[model samples]
Target: MQACQVEQLLADYGTEIYRYCRRLAGFGPDGEDLYQQTFLRLLEADLEPDEGRSPRALLYSVATGLWRNESRKRSRRAAIARPVELDGDDPPPLAGGEEPEAEALKAAENRALAAAVERLPDKYRAAVLLAYGAELPLEEVARIEKLPKGTVKSRLHKARLLLKKEMEARGYGREEL
Candidate 1:
């Protein structure tokens, strides 16, 4: 891809890749680093984005590989003391008409949601992140995970049930998810 096309790809898929990496990394800065590495690998490898297929899935495949490799290296180096906290930092401001209180509430909900996702088992977590978080089709998720469609569906279904229970335990309603 050309320089301009790479920029266009970043503009389009950057946020989704960031979110996917954030959920996988369980923190922001780590996710930010992985996001950069994902794009860097793409650029260095010079793999063209196949528009006929799912760009989101392709981006996530790259992100997941980079995250897993980095995670293994980190685990070998040391254990994590605790899950990172998101309370002090606020999400970026919304456009007009959204109150500060509402934005804060939304951020809190997002944090709770992230925590729940972080608690999931690795398999179900990957399924949920690819299928829902990255908004990829179940077929694409299965392809990415190297699982059958039925297995992906089962994993996503179970992940959703667990997420709903976790959210409710966190004082959120079932419908909220």
Candidate 2:
């Protein structure tokens, strides 16, 4: 494709692409780095598509490769690193709520939910984050993860059940869970 066409494609889909990267990397400064790397790889590759080409599919394929390579690197580093503490460092509650105490409780619940997501196994975590956090279609997520569509569905269902269980155990209750 031409440069302008590529630029337009990026402009149209960039937010979703970055959000996908955030899910893949578990949402942090590291995720932002991976997001940038995904775009860099796309540009560098010029997104050359072979027979049966779909630009969106090509972009997703590149993103998946980048994420997989980074995941491998992270696994190696994780093997040597000490386990980090998981804290429910609650962000400040929104100030305008009619009930300040309720808002504070909600904020705490949000933090606990985030921590629970962080605690999930990488595969399930990826599925949850991509399906819910990034709001991607299950089919697209399956494509990105290189899994069968049904497997992606299964992973997301299992992940949600696990997350709900953990959040409920933490006293998050139905509203928060």
Candidate 3:
């Protein structure tokens, strides 16, 4: 694709890619960096975004690869550590009129989900995120994760089981996983 095409692609899909990155990175500045990195990697690799198909899946596949490489680097740096507490008091609340309880519940759920996902093996985590978080169909998720369809199903099952266990431990008893 030409430079104009790439720019047009960005204009169309940038928000979706950024949203995916934000979710993947647990919604922090790190996520923004990762979003930019995904686009940069695409530029570096010169992979044209195919508009006929799902750009969400394409961006995610590239982002997942980029994230995996970064994870490997962090592991090599001996950076494994327990999850940290994310206190709500640290950041000011949003101006949008959201009920406190609803906001708290949502924030808690997101944090718990993030921690649970972080615990999953990378392959399973990637499958779960692409399938559930990104709302991609199984076939596309399988392709992105580079696994057979059956393998993707199994991984998703395992990920759900693990997430259920994590939620139970976090005291969300019988409330749905």
lDDT of 1 by residue, 1-177 (tens): 466766887999877778788888867689788888888887788877576777666777888878778867876666655555477343333334644687776777787777788878878888888877777888888877878999999998999999898777765564533
Model 1: worst 10 consecutive residues (lDDT sum): 88-97
Quote the lDDT for 30 in model 3.
Answer: 78
Per-residue error for 120 in candidate 1, Å, reads 1.8
Instruction: List RMSD in Å for every model shown.
Output: 6.6, 4.7, 6.0
CA lDDT, every model vs. true structure? 0.77, 0.73, 0.76
Ranking by TM-score: 3, 2, 1
TM-score result, candidate 1: 0.70
Q: Model 3, range 31-65, lDDT digits (tens) per residue?
A: 79999998887777888656676766777889988
Winning model by lDDT: 1
Regarding lDDT, does 1 or 3 come out ahead? 1
lDDT of candidate 1 vs native? 0.77
Q: 42-149 in candidate 2: lDDT tens per residue?
A: 667666655764556566667667777887887888899956967655444333435457777777778777777877887887777767876678877787678999
Model 2: residues with Cα > 4 Å off, grouped in runs: 48-61, 80-104, 174-177
Clashing pairs in 1: none
